[model samples]
Target: MLRDLSRPIETGMPTYPGDPDVTLAPDATHGADGYATSRFRTGTHAGTHVDAPRHTLPEGEAIDERDVGEFAFDARLVDLRPLEQREAIAPEALPDPGAIDDDVDLLLLRTGWASHWGSDRYRDHPYLTAATAERCRAADVGVGLDAFGPDPTPTARGDTESPASDGDEPDGTPAHDVLLGDSLPIVENLCGLDDLPTRFRLYAFPLRLRGGDGSPVRAAAEWDD
Candidate 1:
């Protein structure tokens, strides 16, 4: 069976604050004696999508440079729904690191955040901690989230409890640095992973936009007996 692990891209879909709002305005229709058509305008990260390394890294490669084949593979799911903190995803919350096979290409974190996807809960959602990032590095796996970003803070942190400046860094850098620096791609703002089998074949491909920082992806998974 195949399941869509992506959220519907519509005017109502939740997006990051200050990001462009998704709009669907009809430009032509049969009633107007024209072919059916609609116009779309939104940020590249609007709905369920991937964040190319270039999105966070200063000199990282874009999506086009990353092979499309890299996006399809078998992955294991780790449910992090029990966590309530907005800070880093603690190492203890993770499953047996050895349980994840070195051959598995992606690690999908199944946090039931999609239920609050459109409300205030969506903002400041829990995310992967720096330590967790290091663990992923040792495990050699990419990470995917059902939330907006991998970090709980919009900016970098100073101490464990507070942001550099009033608990807010001028520009977010730690979380992005953790992955992009390691050449491990990240997929964020996904949905429906909570409804699929924990271990399945996942195929998520983005548009072939040459040198594009990021592109929307149609993420899905296949399961069988």
Candidate 2:
């Protein structure tokens, strides 16, 4: 059986401060007189979204070329609920890098922070450290997270502090520098990961928007017997 871990984006769904709030303006509705139609203007990274390599790499491949087959492979979920604020996920947090078979590709990090999937809890959640990103890059693990961003903090001056000085670094340099510089694609804002077995088959496919920086995805994974 397959379980979906993606979060839904709704009219009052949590979003970054400056990002547009999700709103529905009904053009026509069955209740009024006809079929329903609406308009949505939200951030590309809103909700459970996938970040293309181009999102960080200056010349990296767009989301279109990233094959869905790549995601439909062996996977494992690492729990990180023990981590406290500002604590980075290091090599020790991972299973024996060599113990994982060559076929494994998808590496899902479940911080258990999804309990606060939205709201301020979504901001400055635990993050992958530089070493963690580097190791994943070396291991060739298709890394994704159930947090806001790979960076525990924001890169811009006022971004992280906007949520009221949660001790997050004002400059989200280290996290982004490693993940983006390595051309790693990060999937964020995932939920219900705790419901899936640690080992499973994942099938996450992003939009094929030609030359586009990134696109939202309906990512899913299946459990084994």
Candidate 3:
């Protein structure tokens, strides 16, 4: 069985704070031209995308520098739901490092935040604390999530329908410092993880952009039917 875990890139889609907004404009059409083509413009991290270590570290590897095989992984998903909006995910929320299967190279956390896509609540999704992130690295697995990023995407005052819960201050470079600083890739803005089997092979291939700090990806999952 195969399941697409990527979020669609469309004009005017919601993007990370301060990131470029997406736009799809037509450059040619079947009616006017002999072919149909459009000009696509958006930030590399616009939708479902991969963050190469270069996203944070100046000397880190670019997305194209990594081996393509790294895009595919023996993945495991953990459902951490019933979490409050903008809540801090505790380290205990994840499985103990020893319990992780030996074959698992990627760990995905499903917070059900994707359901709030296109809403103000989307920016207020739960985040993984730095401790939780360190734990994942200790487990020796890359991480993915259904929310924005592992760290709290700070909600600007009056930016959402409701205020962020108290103590929602952003943790500077929390997850990224631990995960990406260790040269591990991060897959963000994933959707449909809830439907995937507990164990599946995840593929999140990005465009082969030269020296790209990141690139949008078509993330998918596969397992026995």
Candidate 4:
């Protein structure tokens, strides 16, 4: 059986703050051009997308440069549901390393955040802590999440303080740094994880956009009955 783990991308769908809004404008219609087509525009990191190493590291590999074999893997789904809004999913939340299959190449975290897909609350969803990212890195597996990104808390949007003044980086994306620093790929905004088994085959191929930092993916899982 096959289950789609991608979130539906539609016009006016909720997007990360400051990211471009999705727009689908008709370019050709059956009544006008004898065909049906539309112009689709969205950010590369839009819903159900994969982030390549270049997403965070300046000298890292781009999505198109990655080997196709990396996109398909044996995945283990870890459920961390019933968490409060803006909660930090620490390393303790993950399953024991011994419990994970030796051959598993991917870890998909299900936080049940998809329930608030189109709401403002979606922006306040929980995120993985830096320690959890390090754990995944140590396991040498790709990671996927049901939230916007891996930061446990939102970055200060309009804060004018600089790192020199605040004694901290204006935007601290530690999760991305640790994972992407090692060239690990991350898939964000996954959905329908509740329908998947603990172990399944994940096929999430990103677009071969040259020099692309990330690309939207049609992520899915296959289970054998």
lDDT by residue (65-173, candidate 2, tens digit) is 7776654557778877766644567777876668767877757888877786554545657777677777776776757777777776442345554344445343544
- For model 2 the local lDDT of residue 158 reads 57
* Residue 179, model 3: Cα distance from true site in angstroms: 0.2
Best-fitting candidate, measured by TM-score?
3
What is candidate 4's CA lDDT for residue 13? 79
- TM-scores for all candidates: the values are 0.87, 0.84, 0.96, 0.90
What TM-score would you give candidate 4 relative to the actual structure? 0.90
- Decide which is better by TM-score, 1 or 2: 1
If both were scored by lDDT, which would come out higher, candidate 2 or candidate 3? Answer: 3
Deviation from native of the Cα of residue 173 in model 1, angstroms: 3.2
What candidate 4 gets wrong by more than 4 Å, as runs, is: 153-171
Candidate 2 residues lying further than 4 Å off, grouped into runs, are 31-33, 155-170, 173-177, 180-183
Clashing residue pairs in candidate 3 (N, C-alpha, C atoms within 3 angstroms): none
Backbone collision tally, model 3 = 0
- What is the descending lDDT order? 3, 4, 1, 2
Superior by TM-score: candidate 2 or candidate 3? 3
lDDT of 1 by residue, 24-138 (tens): 8888898886578899987888788887888878698888998878888678888877656465577677665687776787788877777767666566567776777777777
Model 2, residue pairs in steric clash: none
Give the whole-model CA lDDT for all candidates, comma-separated: 0.75, 0.69, 0.88, 0.82
| Ranking of predictions according to TM-score | 3, 4, 1, 2
